[model samples]
Target: MSEEDPDLASRRIAHESLTRDDPTGWFENLYSAAADGAAVVPWDRGTANPLLTEWFEASEPNGTSKTAVVIGAGTGWDAELVADRGYQTTAFDISPTAVETAQRNHPDSQAQYVVADLFNQPAEWQHAFDLVVEIYTVQALPIALQATAIQKVGELVAPGGTLVVIASARAEGQPDAEVEGPPWPLTKATIRSFASAPDLRLIELDESPSPSNPTATRWRAEFLRD
Candidate 1:
């Protein structure tokens, strides 16, 4: 018999532990550190994601009248870019520290930065946004919660509006191998499964090596609410 892979077993255990409804207090701590102006989030590039910017510039000209909502708007980079496209953008994170930092960083961008958890979004937020941008947020949670996140994304979009997601893609059956992570990688099939919900219709799915990290590929998906 083949020897058991300890690494895979450990990963499963870790994921199972993390998937529970642990209070999001740690997220608040992260924001607090950032608010103190010393914390450096690994995913913060200090600027908008270039590929996302490109997509916006290309699609904005053809998009319908709609306000944009950016989920997990860490540090406001993507939110700023979305606002630059002339959309009325509202961005939020569960961390107050992150929201404060975002407000400080983009003092003049007019992007409404708020602190809100996706799992329990305010009732008024339902079906309120025309454009929903989901970037690196779903993968932060355990794989089992991905469907919940995807459902929330759909809930935020207005009828016939669009939802765009950007995430790191992994190979099938390979569990997350990182020691500790906020930027968890997900497989393309997993992403498709999330986007395949009844309320959202998949429009496009594109995969290419991330320009910033040639060793890893990124998946960009566009979905429309029906």
Candidate 2:
């Protein structure tokens, strides 16, 4: 089907429906469908998030061989960007299709792409990373599952490491109207849900204009594991 086809838009909306709740089965099924090469995810922009790239360039994490993990690493744009910054990066997605595509796209990069569910990750990954980048991954799950996702993010960062989350921001006091989304927008409070973790401290939380899509506001928060 053509990218602009009306049927494609309908299918995109259908894919988004799987995120309405923490429906692991539904998500697995959706990914399975794509595993055989079925649909193109609407959110795959084919480029690194400019804001994240800017942050990494400016911060220059001060050490060689730092390890970074990208959660829900759809299309691997963010992962590639981080890896390019000299961090040993691992990018994971629950969808095998997405992981495969990322590997194919970044053949020369040292980024490791894997298929892993964030909700139920292996124990070996706990506290294994010096940097964690979460972009539009938490809100992709149901609101009730948001905290669990946040906790897992915290678990991935080693002490004194950084956790960076980039998410679409909703206006204050916005109600949860019936909206279909894989790009589930979040409020400011929702973004801070992980900031107050006992083992982590909020270092910086900044919202800025989205360069590629200015219609949506974006938040980039950084936390340091204590």
Candidate 3:
């Protein structure tokens, strides 16, 4: 949220859009603005997240080649990681412009870049992917919509597969009202809530302070479906 904080007017518009019932269009708008050179895309690190890199690097590539989907795939760096590991990766963002940007970023990418809303994912995707990589999309949403977002994340997980999540974390007792943000970080309670679905169970969860902000922590969670 630090660098993503654009000019005051732009931030206001984005927050207003999220507070509405849709609670999601602001991402597309923000990415469009960034594309038009109005603001910067703070999360577009142009490289894979270290947590993801470490997770993959430390493990043996043992899973059979199966369908994988990257939610909020953005510019496709993380999707590339999954693809490199031999997963049939399908990376998606809510914004058509963002998907186009991702495709342009990785011209030879094996990952299929598409614009798909998490809340309205295609019916064919239910229980379809072997691995679901969702990073930061929920915290980027207002808390009001995060519950639905959580459910959508679980819905994308196929039986006997896994879901990988990385998101900004909040400490105990930090009220959402205290933080006015388009990218409102989640508390540990919120992070664990994604495991509430009976179909999924948390296998591992890690918390650490953000490298950029010592006060702000982040969570990397892995869930498995039984």
- Write candidate 3's Cα lDDT for 27-129 as tens digits: 7877787787777776777799888887787755554578899999988899999998889999999988889899988999999999899999999999889
Arrange candidates by TM-score, descending. Answer: 3, 2, 1
| Whole-model lDDT per candidate | 0.75, 0.76, 0.84
Q: What is candidate 3's local distance difference test score?
A: 0.84
**Candidate 2 vs candidate 3: which has greater TM-score?**
3
Count of clashing residue pairs in every prediction: 1, 0, 0
Rank by lDDT, highest first.
3, 2, 1
> Best candidate, lDDT-wise?
3
lDDT string, candidate 2, 97-175, tens digits? 6787778888887899998989788798898899999987887665656778888888898888899998888886877
1-226: candidate 1 lDDT, tens digit per residue: 2133433433343344457655344556555544554344556778987768877776764433569899999889999888877778889999787888899888887789998999999998898888889888887766656777877877898887788889988877776554144446777776776556667878888988987779989988888878
Evaluated against the true structure, the overall lDDT of model 1 is 0.75
Candidate 1: segments with Cα more than 4 A from true spot: 1-23, 62-65, 176-180
Best of the candidates, TM-score: 3
Query: Candidate 1 — worst ten consecutive residues by lDDT sum?
Result: 1-10
TM-score, one value per model: 0.83, 0.85, 0.92
